[model samples]
Target chain A: MATLSIENAGKSFGDTDVLKDISLSMDDGEFLVLLGASGCGKSTLLNMIAGLEKVSHGTIRVDGEVVNDVHPKDRDMAMVFQSYALYPNMSVEKNIAFGLEMRGVGRAERKAAVEEVARLLQIEHLLDRKPAQLSGGQRQRVAMGRALVRRPKIFLFDEPLSNLDAQLRVEMRTEIKRLHQTLKATMVYVTHDQIEAMTLADRIAVLKDGRIQQIGTPSEIYNTPANVYVAGFVGSPAMNFFEVTLERDGDQIGVMLPAKLKGVDTPYFLPLPAGGQYHSHIGQPVVLGLRPEMISQATTAAPEDPVITCDVDVVEPTGADTLCVIRLAGRGAKARVSPAFACEPGDSMEFALDMSRACVFDAETGMRLYG
Target chain B: MPQPKGGSSHRTVLDKLSRFLPQLVVAPSFLLILFFVYGFIIWTGYISFTDSRMLPAYEVQGFRQYFRLFAMDRWDVAFDNLLVFGAFYITLSLAIGCLLAVLLDQRIRAEGALRTIYLYPMAISFIVTGTAWKWMLNPSLGIESYIRGLGWESFRFDWIVDKDMAIYVVVIAAVWQASGFVMALFLSALRSVDQEIVKAAYLDGASTTRIYLGIILPSLRPVFLSAFVILAHLSIKSFDLVVALTGGGPGYASTLPANFMYEMTFRRNQIGLGAASAVMMLLTVAAIMVPYLYSELRGKRHA
Candidate 1:
């Protein structure tokens, strides 16, 4: 229900900087997720937003009012911790109504609010039970119910689904996304899981080593990552990298493939789709990045899309798609192919590479060079 | 192939010894406890029903010792004093212990040193504690004369010699010697509590006092029960503190049940009455312990 903005927020513990120059603004009713590996300062940033942690230097504003020094209770935000953090001694109903009771809401009103949230979470029968009586997923619902009952200006979730089992985590992830959609509340979530980020967030902010690597919509982050790190981090069977030199052959600029192919007698030239864009980098070594799905079983294609032969080293079937490992530029690279396009290990297979969808990065900087 | 039977027989002997080793090691202590503790309890139970004076008399008498024990004014006073002492000792100790633990839980800079200082009293025996407090409470030698010497003409601070208030002095000494232990129990439980619960309560707008009273303290129900059972047994069995401090002084006003039993058995040579009172004390302790043990074991199984 409120637009939140943080300006140049930084945090340091004694001599070590934990977060630096974190600046982002959220629109009202937006769902933003901070995605990163452990120790990436995502949880720290979320804590700062909740006012549970002091920002060593920065200004945080809510709805155009500076709230840099406001207490967590006065910041008008609710946090669902990873552990659920329900009052172990209180019944589920009491746990949901605790904040309202603290605010001095009437008994009748508190009961109605608790019942409504219990029904919303489909945990009406569990209201009388203590937290220890409930399962992990049930406790998660009660935790969310507690946060939702207050209707705070902002909702902060610090990996609320991290404690649940795989099946229950997916179910709770859907439930959280549905709640965000129904309430249209401003929510900020922190998680190390990219799948949850891709599925639940309107925009994902990828972080590493206490700094934001990139912030954009899920598709933008996946299809056009800002750097090789972002590209490799967001996808499963992570993007493959191959070192090659950008060479121009009669105005057709592209990366050169090694002669390491099983059936090839000499190195091959793989032309770029829009060859002129990379002409300035001719003769410079660059890293080519491509998703596993971009390379598949060979098919009749246009001249821009090239097919090359390589020896398959391994085959893995994942029900929906089959993955084959092949030697490319003297490194094992995974290529996802249709399960029907079967190839066994030690067999030479022809696969087509989609150059337009591929990504190119500077070998030295690991930054995106061309897409 | 010819030696396989010999090897198997040798392994069987070793296996049997391994199975029997634990019981063999435990037999001595088990037998000692059974004879010294439970054996004396049965002997005492039998003696309570006999007309024994100065020593064990084998002639069984029917309910006469209990009748005499119930009728004595000294026994009546000792029973009443046990209640008063137990009430004040358990409640005041618990209140003070909980307060100290909560204050020390605030991440203070000198927590280690302060906790050690608070807990030092429990390390001293009740006799030592009583002797020290006796010197401090003596009207002429300790606080009263020292204060009067500082220019006040009248400073009366002699609870140890006061007959009506002597039991309270016993309670004070016992609480001082035991509250530190209660504080240690509560402090360990307080340390194990999930800290995220406290943070959540803070965000829910709970003040520090309300958070403690409503959320944190209620979760420590087990600790409270444990402290109650421990303190209850200790108060019922209190003897040395009263002996060393007040000596049940100014009459038999401050005598607890244990002291009464000792007086009747050793000093008065009324063995029957002493055994009757000792059996009553055992029953009281059992009454508190049985339910606590039952609930504790049942809770573990459920968990």
Candidate 2:
């Protein structure tokens, strides 16, 4: 196990900067995931950590020692690639034993290590089989086995499960999490899949356009996204945004609900959480961010919860919960309701908006304003 | 509108003819190859056992020509030259070709121009290659005289005229002509190798040399087999090169099997002996090619 620190790392290919001023450090045995969409430099950062790509600027340190100029092999890191990257010419046993042999380990010890890794990966029967002869999952296991046999200081995975089928990906994801728990090794995994990042990482560094958008725990990122991009990029079905004009109402500040319930103009007011940073910007436009779960059927209709009746445009049942699409301030807003709650398109339903859990963002700049 | 019965019949006939047109177009060439290539091979096999001399003779005298061809000292020398030339040519060509391929694969600038420069020799006919090398290897007229003019008076690059070393000169010329083709084949195979595998090896603590030698080169087993098959066939059928370069001179010292066959059949009127030698050359090529083709076809089927 080792600590990995990348300080002010930047990479440029010709005139285009692929990663810019990225600084991140992980403690020993920490599972840090670099998450981003394509062309966001997540994979480039992973390659730099693996020493497969050179750092154009800044320093990479491992175990508190500078490894900016160290070769990948000497850096004592083992990597599992998205393609599995198992040597096609070698058998599973030889594939796992290759690093040891290259490092000049004795033949008998190499064999023993190979056997141990095969057993650990539950691929003992595949020891003599070539990569082409193995299934996708088996090949992934052998790739992991190859890295594990080396027992390196840090383990780097480059979207290793992306090539697998959906079911296999989930199974392998769990297997990798279990492996990390058992080994307690520092792992830096790069992935474009938000689900993989959310489920696997101890701390995720969400990247956008070669810059870190936010670096926090999965819960922290989900509960409080740093910007409009982070909030939109993280969740499935995404958080809804509505143009709202903040208004001061004596002791409380609130936003007007321009609701047309039952074909009648109803005067409605939804109170904003008190002490928001953007409270002084009343009467100005701000994008109100409300997750689907934050707006549901009002079961008890508590005094603090603001209830608004709106015509449901569409109703989609997704097994456990039904999603009701309704118009909120001239924009489509999705509200999650219990499957048991009977509702249909064109039916008016009262959704209790949880103002405490909602977020506000600046309309011009996509940065989050306040809670 | 409904067509008349006669017009409909004509249209059906035309459609049938159009369906059969591709096969009709290809039939003549197919029959020509069957008769001239396979039929001639069978006829040659039959003639090898006959007592034909000076012309085509129908009388059979089984194995007599074969025994005589094997017994001749000139034939023995020709066979020896073939062995030497084939071994040296194939080994040298593969080595030089693989090295050139590796160097060219280094993402160099002006790669297209450099690749064309190396590959240009493969476009030249073996006869042209032979004649060109012949002038260069000629001691008094070529490199020897040029070097002597440069004040090296005792320069002796006369392998073309030397009896023992004449076959090696053929090896050198043939390698120069064919190694580029081999390099092209190997370069394509090298480019197709997965880049991630190389990176994985690098992180596995293997140096660049080790990654290539231990991982990359071993994976190119199919290309190696292909190069060997092509070189072996080319070596066995070599005639124009030996003739243009050495002319089977120095008392048949540099004569390969094909040259010996041509000399025996046309020049020396030993038709049966020539037929026997030709059949032997065919068998040698088949021995190298059959297993390779079988494995290649089988691999394709499996894939």
Candidate 3:
């Protein structure tokens, strides 16, 4: 295993900059996942580390040695592609042995290595069969076997499980995590799936529009997202954003919600957490970032929780939790409640908002305002 | 009830006509092929057993023409030339075509124009190719005199007139006309190869040459079989090229089997012997085609 450091790395195709001023470093045996939507430069960054692509700006050092000019094979990295890119003409044994043969390994050693990998991957029976003869999952195993036989310094997986079926994808995802733990190899995995990043990565780097938006542990990224984009991109059912003006109500600072209490024209005031950084910004516009789980049925509310009542616009039952869309502060917001909480569209329901977990962002800049 | 019976009867007649329409449309061409192609083959087979000369007389003298065809010195020379020409032509064309295709697949800038230039000769008839090569190989008129004019007095490119070398001239013309078509076949096959496999091989530490030989070329076995089958048939039935370029001349020194059959049938009035030669040519083509067809069809069935 080796530490990989990408320093001030940038890539440009003619005039279009795909990745700009990106700097990331990994400790030995650390799993770093680069997560983003499509066209967000995560795959390009992974390719640069693998030497499949050249860094247009800065140096990439592996194990403290600059490898900008090194060939990919000499750099000693193994990659598993999304397509599983197995050589179709070769039997599974030969496919796994091809890299070792290219590295000039002896026949007996190559055979032993192939046998070991085949047993580890549970594919010994598939050794004599060609890639076309294998199922999708079997082919994925062979692709991994081809990479593992060489015992490279680093493992690079470019959306390797994306091509499998949903059920098989989760199974392989767990297997990859288990393998990473057992092998203790420095791995850099690139994927657009947030769940994969959350489940596999030691630290997740969320990327957007060719820039790193946030880099943290999965809970840190999900709980305290750096900005509105990170808040929205990293979660299922997405964090709700409420555009509201901060009001100084006596000694407490709070945001006024547009929901009515009974039949009155008065707006509901939900108090912010005590002593937030936005205390001095009273009467300024800010976006309140609240995850769906932060708002729930009033029955589950703690005594200190702030409560508000709103008309439900839509309800989506996802088995474990029912997601209710309600209007607050003149914008749509999602609330996660128990499926047993019987409510429908056009029904008035009381939702308890957990103030401590909610974040406020600057309305104009979209940056988080309070720590 | 009577009106309903009449409507049902009308519908049945229309259905019968619809079923017969496709067969009716195909019958003319099918009958024409059966009479002209297969019928003539049977008639030719029968005539080979008779002693027909100057005209076809259908009185059987069994195996007489085959004995005479085997005894003739001209027939021996033609058979020998076919073996030499077919062997060299198919091998050289396949090698040259595959090389050109590999070169073109290198993401070249002017690839469209270059591919068209290579493939333009295939658009012209084989007769045109033979005539062009005939002019180019003429000692007094073409490359020989042209080079001699530039003060190289020892330049001698008179392969067209050289009795011992004239058959190779036919091989050259055939290779030139067909190699580009073969290149087109190979280029498409190369294009269809999964590029990610090459990238994976590169990361595996294989050089560009090794990647192609070990992975890419092995996957192109089907294309190789296809090119071989096509070139084989073209070599066996090579008639117009020999006729247009050499005219079986320099005292019948470079005569191929087809040219020999023509000379015996129409020119020397040895019709029965010509039929026997034609039957031999058919057997040679069938020997190549039968196994190829069986294997190809069997592969499709398994797939």
After superposition, the stretches of candidate 2 with alpha carbons farther than 4 Å from their true spots are A249-251, A256-269, A298-303, A309-316, A324-333, A345-350, B1-26, B300-303
Q: Could you tell me every candidate's TM-score relative to the true structure?
A: 0.94, 0.93, 0.93
* Candidate 3: docking tier: medium
Q: Model-by-model lDDT, in order? A: 0.91, 0.91, 0.90
Report the CAPRI category for model 2.
medium
Q: Which residue ranges in model 1 land beyond 4 Å of their true spot?
A: A259-267, A300-303, B1-3, B149-153, B301-303
lDDT of 2 by residue, A82-191 (tens): 99999989998999999999899999999999998888899999999899999999999999999999999999999999999999999999999999999999999999
| Cα distance off (Å), candidate 1, residue A305 | 2.3
lDDT of 1 by residue, B20-60 (tens): 99999999999999999999999999999999989999899
Count backbone clashes in candidate 1.
Answer: 0
Which candidate, 2 or 3, would have the higher DockQ against the true structure?
2
For candidate 3, write residues A106-196 as lDDT tens digits: 9999999999999999999999999999999999999999999999999999999998999999999999999999899999999999999
What is the Cα-based lDDT of residue B24 in candidate 2? 95
Ranking by DockQ: 2, 3, 1
lDDT of 1 by residue, A19-54 (tens): 999888999999999999999999999988888789
Model 2, residue B211: displacement in angstroms?
Answer: 1.0
Model 2, B1-303: lDDT tens digits are 999999999999999999999999999999999999999999999999999989979799999999998899998999999899999999999999999999999899998898898899999998999999999989888999999999988879998889999999999999998899999999999999999999999988888888888889989998999899889999999999998999987778999999989999999888888999999999988888888889889989999
| iRMSD values, candidates in order | 0.7, 0.7, 0.8
Better of 1 and 2 by DockQ: 2
Q: In candidate 3, residue A117 scores what lDDT? A: 95
